[model samples]
Target: MRLPEHFLNNRKLESLVENQSSFTLDHAAMHIFETHQQAEQVLLQFDQPVLASMIEGKKVMHLRDYESFQFLPGESLVLPSGELMCIDFPEAEYENPTRCLAMAISEEKITKVLDWMNETMPKTGGLHWGLMDYNFHFVNDAAVFQILQRLVFLFTEDHPYKDYFVDNMLRELIIRILQTNELKIYGSDTFTLRENSRLAHVVRYIRTHLHESLDIATLSKEACMSASHFHRVFKNELGISPVEFINNERVKLAVSLLQNPEISIKEVYMCCGFESRSYFNRVFKHKQQITPGDYQRLLQRSMF
Candidate 1:
């Protein structure tokens, strides 16, 4: 899908912020910045650290409290909050200008997601690490490139419900990150899923039983590991505990249901596995920043 003309026309890189811009729910807090010529080092001081995966090109990052490193396309990097960093593009030759996607997400939002995980699955703590940095060689990884292209189109589009589409794309992008991690863990000749393996069986179990009542014990049993050990392995592999993973999936389902005007909030609650309407409302509102009814109204308004 091509980006709408309006969004493209409205694109303004806010320079005053000094490498950062205000956050917006309209597009998953992501931005694509391109440079035709090598520019001076870009310094960014973020309120919260970011998990950044490179989509294309090469860049060097000087991170606070971490060793400086060069990130090629298809590599991932994590920048912790309050940390200052300098990013530079050192490559001298490029047929096309270098491009990168800067996804700025709130630590608070991520924490909420983590909180949901602990609530639904008490055994799981959460991701111990705060950063995810990676590079993707889009030339070789055509599939990953295609996903990024789709996102670019959505971001440039001017549709009334562009934010909705962008949010969906963001979800897809994150899923791709998980897939990348999976491939990295399992592609090596020595890759193994022993008790300490990041590719634990619990994640697969949860994915298979989304509609079922899944808890720490059930998931741990599926992995044939103790609940505590399972939780530790899960957080190490997926960046979030098993419980948080389930709630994120549930919220994703709830959002899909809310998009359908025919589906009532009460119905959504039951369908998504929430036993109480009030609790569903609370969780949905906290994650989505709006009540289910209000979300429906916004969707309707966008349609018109």
Candidate 2:
């Protein structure tokens, strides 16, 4: 959702019937699509694995083996090589068009990362570190979204070391996707399935005690490892510190509380396990880029 400002302000999304634009790098390319008419059953396919995200408007996606669903902004879909997709733009118009981006990553680059993972960070089960064979759909979490935003910027921006920058970003995006898939499979659906995995163990403890006081020492105890070792491996596995993850969870709780006008903003911090108003405000603003009071006012304005 980190659309370029120029694109947002004064875009000439005209003349072209389909409106396809591209920005290509050595290892990665971003293909943009915009539809100006009501289109049904538009077939799209990619030669390489792509992370497709909805930037604006909506799409009815019909993957090969999955059920048809509405793909909206803030959602991402990862497709393997040569996966065919049938998309429907039910609400596209001249003024309100459906826009999406297909981030095609090279096969050689993906293989390099997978080889590293299989050798260095293999899973507990028989599953190896490979891309999902089928379609993988997920809500865009903050970490994943931030990486996507950066990748988009890197793809479009003209930097001297653009390839180097993109390689790092692509590597980051791959790791995040892999960890997300692992969590989707083992952490959420089958928590008991991988009790032996220290990473999964710590993730479970974090989710269960999201509102409770969480510390690296306590989480390391749950993982049965030293605090230092836990900190290193946890970052390697999940791409964030243990305390940042806890704060993210707390902010999630705070957002849910803020939806209700009956609850005062002063009460939300304590209910979400924050210690004080100043700390809560700082963390909330840091995470969401807005203070709690402004968020409350925005929500109120939206409800009107």
TM-score to native of every candidate shown: 0.45, 0.72
Model 2: runs farther than 4 Å from truth?
1-17, 23-25, 117-128, 132-134, 141-165, 183-192, 207-212, 248-304
Candidate 1 is scored at a TM of: 0.45
The residue-by-residue lDDT of candidate 1 on 109-213, one tens digit each, is: 555544543454333233232223433222214455566667666655557887777666655555445444544453333545555432445555554566678
lDDT for each candidate structure: 0.59, 0.80
Candidate 2, lDDT over the whole model: 0.80
lDDT of 2 by residue, 1-304 (tens): 7678755555556532347778889899988788877888888888988999898889999987688999999998989889989988889888887888889999899999999887886653344677754488888888889988888777777789989998988887888887776555543434454556777767777777765777888988888789998887666655567777678778888888898988898889977778889999999999999999899889989998
Clashes of each: 23, 0
